[model samples]
Target: MSDSIRLDKWLWAARFFKTRTLATTAVELGRILQNGQRVKPAHGVKLDDMLQIEHAEQVWEVKVLRVLEVRGSATVAQTMYQETEESAEKRAKAAQDKKYYREPGASVAGRPTKRDRRQLDFTRN
Candidate 1:
C-alpha cells in the first residue's frame, strides 16, 4: 500500500514482466532505466518517475502513476503507468514494420547438414 515500491515489483504489478524475477533480471541486465539512469531491481519507484524499459525489440517510455503491492488484472495493471504518446507511436510503427518486413533469415535454415553436404559432393563428382 506504499506510494513507493521496488522497481522489480512495480514492473511485475504493472505487467511489464510476467514475473518479478524476470523484471529483476532485466533491471540487472540494464534493460530498465529510471529517469535515463540505470536502476537496480531494488530501486525505489515513486510516483511521476519516468522509466525507460526494453523488452524484446520494443522500447517503452512510461510515467509511474501509482505503486501497488499486488499484481492485478491487465486492465488494473495498465493504470499503474502511463506510456508516452511518442513511445506508443514508435512501438506501433515498429510492430507494423516488423509485420511487413521481417528478417530474411527468420524462416531460413542456414547451412546444410553433414549428410546433405556429402550427398551434394557425391552428386557433383
Candidate 2:
C-alpha cells in the first residue's frame, strides 16, 4: 500500500514469520539480511530489494515484489516476494536429502552405547 514498509512488518505480512514479534527477534538475531547486509527491524523494505532470510533451518533468498504492512492469506503472502531459482532448488535438494538420509541417532533407543559415548567424547574435544 505504502511506498515502503518496515522489514519486520513486511516479513510478518508476507508470512515469513508467524508474528511481528518473531520477525523482530529474527531481525535482531541477524536471521534477516537486506541487500546482503544485516538490517534493523525498522529498516525500510522496498520493491525489488533482495533479501536473505534464515528460518526453521531453511534459508530463503527472495526479491521483494510487494511491500505490505497487513498480513494476508497464504496465496497473497506468497505473491509478496519471489524466491530465487537457486534457493528453491537448494531447498528442494535439502528436503530430499533429509527424507532419504535421516540422522543416524534419530531412531536410537534409550541408552547410549559405549561406542556412541566414545565417539561423542572424541568429538567434544
Candidate 3:
C-alpha cells in the first residue's frame, strides 16, 4: 500500500525471494539491481521501476507494478509486480540449457584434495 518499499521487503512481498533475509543476502552479494545498478537491501523501490535479480545462474528482469511494505500470500504477492517478457524467455532458456549439463553425482569437482597436492609436490621434487 506504500508508494515505495524497502528493497528486501519488496522482493519478498513480490515473491521474488522466499524470505527477507535471503533477499538481503542477495542484495549484499550484488545480485539485486534496480535500473541496471546494484542496490542495497534498504533501497527504496517505486512503481514502474525495473529490477534485475540474479538467482542461482538466472537473472530476472521485473517491473514494479505496486508497492507493499508487508509480506503477503503467494496469490496476493503475485499481484504486486510483473515480469518482463524477455526476462521470462531468458529464464526458460537458461533452465533448458541447464538440463543438458545436469549429471548425477557431479559435485562441483574443484581443485585437487590435500593428499593429491602433497603427492604431486613430492613427485615434482
Candidate lDDT (C-alpha), each: 0.91, 0.92, 0.85
Candidate 3 structure quality by residue, lDDT tens digits, 49-87: 999989877888888888988777889888887889999
Mark the regions of model 3 whose C-alpha exceeds 4 Å error after superposition. Answer: 103-105, 108-125
Q: Give the per-residue lDDT digits (tens) of candidate 1, residues 1-125.
A: 78789999999999989989999999999999999999899999999999999998899999999999999999999999999999999999999999898653344367867766676666667
- What is candidate 2's lDDT per residue for 22-65, written digit by digit as tens? 99999999999999999999999999999999999799999999
Number of backbone collisions per candidate = 0, 0, 0
Superior by lDDT: candidate 2 or candidate 3 = 2
Ten-residue region with minimum lDDT total, candidate 2: 101-110
Estimate the TM-score for candidate 3: 0.78
Best by lDDT: 2
Scored against the true structure, residue 39 in model 1 reaches a CA lDDT of 82
Quote the RMSD, in angstroms, for model 2. 4.2
Which pairs clash in model 1? Answer: none
Which candidate has the highest TM-score of all? 1
Instruction: Give the distance in Å from residue 33's predicted Cα in candidate 3 to where it truly belongs.
Output: 0.7
